[model samples]
Target: LGSVLLLLALYVLQGVPLGLAGSVPLILQSRSASYTEQAFFSLVFWPFSLKLLWAPLVDAVYVRRFGRRKSWLVPTQYVLGLFMIGLSRRVDALLGDGQGRGPDVVALTATFFLFEFLAATQDIAVDGWALTMLSRENVGYASTCNSVGQTAGYFLGNVLFLALESPSFCNKYLRFQPQPRGIVTLSDFLFFWGAVFLITTTLVALLKKENKELTPTKEETKGITDTYKLLFSIIKMPAVLTFCLLILTAKVGFSAADAVTGLKLVEEGVPKEHLALLAVPMVPVQIILPLIISKYTAGPQPLNTFYKAMPFRLLFGLEFAFLVWWTPKVKHEGGFPVYYYVVVLLSYALHQVTLYSMYVAIMAFNAKVSDPLIGGTYMTLLNTVSNLGGNWPSTVALWLVDPLTVKECVGAQEQACGTAAAAELCTKAGGSCVTTLDGYYVESVVCVILGFAWWFLFGPKLKKLQDEGQSSWKCKRTN
Candidate 1:
C-alpha cells in the first residue's frame, strides 16, 4: 500500500508539468498561430522522446548516501518547483490577453522546455525506483500506478485549471456571485502546485528511507558506456531494428486527429473553458481504458489490437474534420445546442477507446518482446521510439497547417493573404482575409490517405514481426 502510494505521488508530480504544458496551447489558441502553439508543445515534449539518451547516466551515477533515486529525484523536484514559481511570475505576460496583445512564444518555449526537462529527469528516477519499491510479484502494478497518477495529475493541471480559470464556467457552475474572471488564474495555479511539489518532495526526502537491499551494487549497475553499447547492440538486431522503425512510424496516421483537433475547435470559436470541460468525462476513460485493453493485449499478437484500432482512429480524423465544419452551424445566438455537445462527447469517447487500445497494445508488445537481460534499457529504447512516433508527426502536422490552408483578401484589391502581415495589410486596406480553405481539413484528408497507405503497406510486416522467434530480438552481450 505504501509503495503504491509513493509511486502514485511521484508519477502525479511528474505528470502535472506535462498537463500544464498541454493546457498552454489551448489557452494561447486565440492569441498565437496554430503552428506556434504546436511548436511550443513540440519543444516542451521533446525531452520525453529524447530522455532515453541520458537514461543511462541517470541510472549509473548517484550518491550512495543520498540513495540512487533520491540523488536525482530530490534535486530535480526542487528545481522544478523553483522553475514553476519563477514562471508563474511572468506567465501572464507570456500568455498575453486574448485581445490585441500576442504571446511571446520564444520565451514561453524556453521556460517550459527547461521545466519539462526537469520533469523528465524526475520520471526517469521514479520509473527506476518503482521496480525496487515493490515486491517482484507486485511489480506489474507500477505501470498501473503510472497510468492513473499521470492521468489524474494531467486532469487537475489542464482540465480543472482551465475550467476554474474561466469566468463564465465559474459563474455558471460554482460561483454564487458573478465575477469578471475565474476563481484562479494561471499564475496562482502554477505557484500553488510549485509549492506543493516542494513540500511533498521535502517530506519524501526526510521521512522515507531507501532500502539498502534494494539498491543496485557495483556489479549489477552498468557504466554509462556499457549501457549505450547495449542500447546500440539492441538496435543492431534485425528484428529489433525493424520493430523500432515500426514504432517510430506508427502514429503518423493518428497525429492530426489526436494533436490538432481540439486546438482547431478552439480556433473555430469553441470556448477554451468548454473544450477543457469536454475533457472532464475523458479523465476516467483514459485511466480505466488501459486496464481493460491490457486484457486483450496479453495475447500472443498484441499488435493485432493495434492494427484493429488504427483504421477507427484514422476514420475519426474525418469525423473530427466534419465536427469542426459543423460546429459554427449548430452554434446559436446563445451557445452551442445540447445535441452538439452530446455528439462531440460521444465522438471523443469513441476516439479515446481506439487511442487507448493502440497504446496498451503497443506497450504490451514492447514488454513481451523486450530482452529480459537488458530489460529496462530495452523497454526504454522501444518506448522512446513510440513517443517519437507521436511527437514528430504531430509537430509536422502543426507546421504544415498554415502552409496548406488557403485564404484570399476579399475587397477592392482582391489579393492573396498568405501571411499574417498580408492579412493585416488586407484588414488595413478595407478588406478581409476570408479562409477559402481550412488547413485542418486539407491536413486531415492527407493524413487519412497517408494513414491508410501506411496501414496497408506495414500491416503485414507487423504481423510477421510479431510471429518472429524471440531469439531474433535478443542481443549478445559484449565484454
Candidate 2:
C-alpha cells in the first residue's frame, strides 16, 4: 500500500506542469493567446522527459547513498512539497504585479524543471524497487497496483485539478463579475500536490517491509566508485549495449507522434477545458491496460513469444495510424467539441497499452536470457537505456519549442535566441509561429520515419535478442 501510494503521489506530481501550462494561454496574458503559447508551455516537459540522462545516478549515487528507494524519495518529496508552497507564495508576487511572460514563465518553469528532475530520479528508485521487492510470484499483482496508482495520479493531476479554473485568482484578476482566468499559472495550485507527495513520503518512511536477502553487503558496496562509473560499466556489457541502442531508438518516434497529437488539439484551437475531458478514458486505461499487457506471460515466456507478440510491429502501425486519424477541430460550438481530446486520448490509451505490453514482454524476455544472479544490474542497465531513450525526444522537442530569434521572426530583437535555443523560437515571436509548427510537424514525421526504418534495419537482431529474453532463466525455471 505504501509503495503504491508513493508511486501515486509521484505520478500525480508529474502532471502539475501539464495542467498548469495547458491553462496558461487562456489566462489574461500579454502574449498572443495562440497555439504558440501552448508550445512554450510544452517546453516544460523536456526536463521531465530527459530524466533518462541522470537515471544511472539515481541507481549509483542517489540510491547508493541513502538506499535505492529512500535516497531519491526523501529529498524529492520534501523539495516538491516546499517548492510548491513557494510557488503558491510566488504567485502572490507574480500575479500581484501581473509580471511579464519572460520573468514569470522562466521563474516557474525553472522550479518546475528541478521538481521534474527530482520526480524523474525518484521514478527510477520506485520502479527498481518494484522489481526487487515484490516476490517474483507477486510481480504481476504488484504491477497492477502500481499502474492503478499511477493512472489515478495522472487523471487527478492533469484532469480534475487542471480543469478547475482558479476561482480565487479569477475572483482577484477578473473581479466580482467572475471572469474566469482559464487556468492558473505554473505555481498556481500545486500546494495540494505537495501535500500528496509529502504524505506519501511520510507513509513510506513509516512502512516496515522485508529487505532483500540477496542484496550484497559492505565489501560489495566498496566496488562502486560513483554513479557515472557504475553507469559506464553497466552500459559496456554486451547485451546491455544492444538493450541501450534498442531502448534509445524505440520510443523516439512514438513519443514524437504522441507529442504532436496533443499539440494538434492546442494548435487546432481546442480549449484546455476541452483537453480536460481527455482524462475520462484514463479510467479504462487504469483498470484494463496493464492487465491486457500482462496476459500473455506466465512466470515469463520464451523470446519466440515476444517476436510473435509483434510488439514493434503493432506499435509501428498503431502510432502511424493514431497520428493520422486523430485530427483536431479548430473550435467548438453550442455543445463541447471535445471530440479531438477524446480521440487523442483513445490513441494514447492504445499506445500505452501496446508500449507497456511490449516493454514488459521484452523485460521478461531479458530476464530469461541474462544470468539470473545479475538481474539487479541488467535491469539497471535496461533502465539506463530507457533513460537514454527519454533524452533524445526531449532534446529535440525542447529545441523545437524554444523559438528562433526576433531577427528571424519579424525584425531583429538582438536579445533573443539562436538555433541552439531551438530554431522554433523564432516562430514563437508571433509572426513566425506557423513556421515553427511546420518544423514540429517535420520533426515528428522524421521520427516516425526513423522508427519505421529502425523496425526494418534492426528487426532481425531484436528478434534474436527478444527470443533469448524469452528463454527461462535457470533460476526462474527452478522457482
State how far residue 140 of model 1 sits from its true place (Å). 3.8
> Candidate 2: misplaced stretches above 4 Å?
1-75, 91-106, 121-142, 166-178, 182-188, 195-223, 226-231, 297-346, 401-437, 467-479
lDDT by residue for model 2 over 1-479, one digit each (tens)?
A: 55455444555555454445444443423223323434454455565445555665565554444465676667777777776676766654543344433435545456556656666666666665665555556666555655555555556656655455544434644565765354554454677666766776776666734354634453245334444454456566566677568767766656555444454444444445455655685676656754665567535453344444444534544454444434432334543355644655666666666566666676665555555554455555565556557556644653554342132445424323344343355545433422323444555556667766766677567666644433232222211
Tens digit of lDDT per residue, candidate 1, span 131-201? 88888888999988998898888888888898898888899999999999899999999999999999999
Each candidate structure's count of clashing pairs: 0, 13
Shift of residue 98 alpha carbon in model 2, Å = 9.0
* Backbone clash pairs in model 1 (N, Cα, C under 3 Å; residues 3+ apart or in different chains), count: 0
TM-scores for all candidates: the values are: 0.96, 0.67
- Candidate 2 C-alpha error for residue 373, in Å: 1.4
User: Against the hidden true structure, what lDDT does model 2 obtain?
Assistant: 0.53
Cα lDDT for residue 381, model 2? 53
